[model samples]
Target: MEIRLRVESAVRDEAEELTSALHDWLREDRDVGRHARIGRLADSGGAPSGAMSADWFGWVQLIAGSGFSTAGLVYAHNAFRASLPRRQQTVSVVIEHNGTRIVLEDASPESAARIAEILSGSGDDEEAPGGSS
Candidate 1:
């Protein structure tokens, strides 16, 4: 369960702030683990081989244990969004396991947070139908 958050295209100051916030959050939770800055796309000299400015836009990665459910992943995303400021910005989050990938995006952090919460079951806990927990 290695969680790595790599923030790219972020202004130096903003990136620093984001990194610090992530550290604090991860520290408070035992489920969350190590945080590392593998590399930054902006500092990669030129654009990545196949990543476009639009396609390879800024992103953050959370490497967690294998047993983590998708719901948990969604919860983490929502938590990250909640920590951000209210501003107009496009964000794309990709969670990769083995060779598979799950992507989530939003034009605004608030919307992303809402969607993540719904998917994560951290939102309204009302039962959905047939007495399913």
Candidate 2:
């Protein structure tokens, strides 16, 4: 699955750096490293498309492959959040996966995992009694 993660910051200039930081952080994960990459959105002159901000630099794209699990992506994201200082605060995060958009503003581990399960379609089986599919 392809996941687009954008770090929203009040400082427009900081957005790009923050996104790159996330990409680097994700690479530290053995499983998520190779699959994670920084993605760029092409600019159309001075005005950007209605779909996104013109000033928006880009975001980190995490494509989970056979070697990595969706859970790893969640782990990397949370870890990155924990690494941030107060000065480098991120307003929020918009994650788009398979047309399912999830906006997170300081979500807890449980909440994050539950979201991952939901997005990966793993919650259904786990929710079933005796783990039946």
Candidate 3:
């Protein structure tokens, strides 16, 4: 199975930087790197601050294979967040499935875990995206 994630940040420069960070992480993680890869280069159209772009200002494509685990991704995200100072950063994630896209932002812990389980294709609960436990 494959999972595609679209990541975005409120600040254009931050968006670009985060996209690169995510891509590098996925590529360098031993376990995840064995089964997953960055599907494509992050799409951050070069322009001035207010330039129009695709659905999101920045994007990340997370392609997970059989060996990849949702927990790892979550852990990586948490680690990344921990390294940053406490501040209100608007980072959004969108998952695409069967042509439908689900946007996730500021989700509760339960909802975030549930979404991860769903995306990892390891959940049997059949809960909708962003659903809390």
Against the reference, the lDDT scores of all candidates come to: 0.41, 0.61, 0.56
TM-score ranking of the models: 2, 3, 1
- Residue 34 in candidate 3 has what lDDT? 73
Q: Scored by Cα lDDT, where does model 3 land?
A: 0.56
Q: What would the TM-scores of all predictions be? A: 0.42, 0.69, 0.63
lDDT of 2: 0.61
- lDDT (tens digit, per residue) of candidate 1 on 47-80: 3234433423233344445554444444554676
Q: For residues 22-57, could you state the per-residue lDDT of candidate 3 as single tens digits?
A: 667667767667777665543544432553654443
Give the Å error, residue 26, model 2. Answer: 1.1
RMSD of 3: 4.9
Better of 2 and 3 by lDDT: 2
Which predicted model would earn the best lDDT? 2
What 10-residue stretch in candidate 2 is worst by lDDT?
124-133
Worst lDDT run of 10 residues, candidate 1, spans: 124-133
Which lDDT tens digits does candidate 2 get at residues 37-112?
5455432223212334565556677766666667777777677787889665444665666655555666466647
Residue pairs clashing in model 3 are none
What are the RMSD figures for all models against the true structure?
9.9, 7.3, 4.9
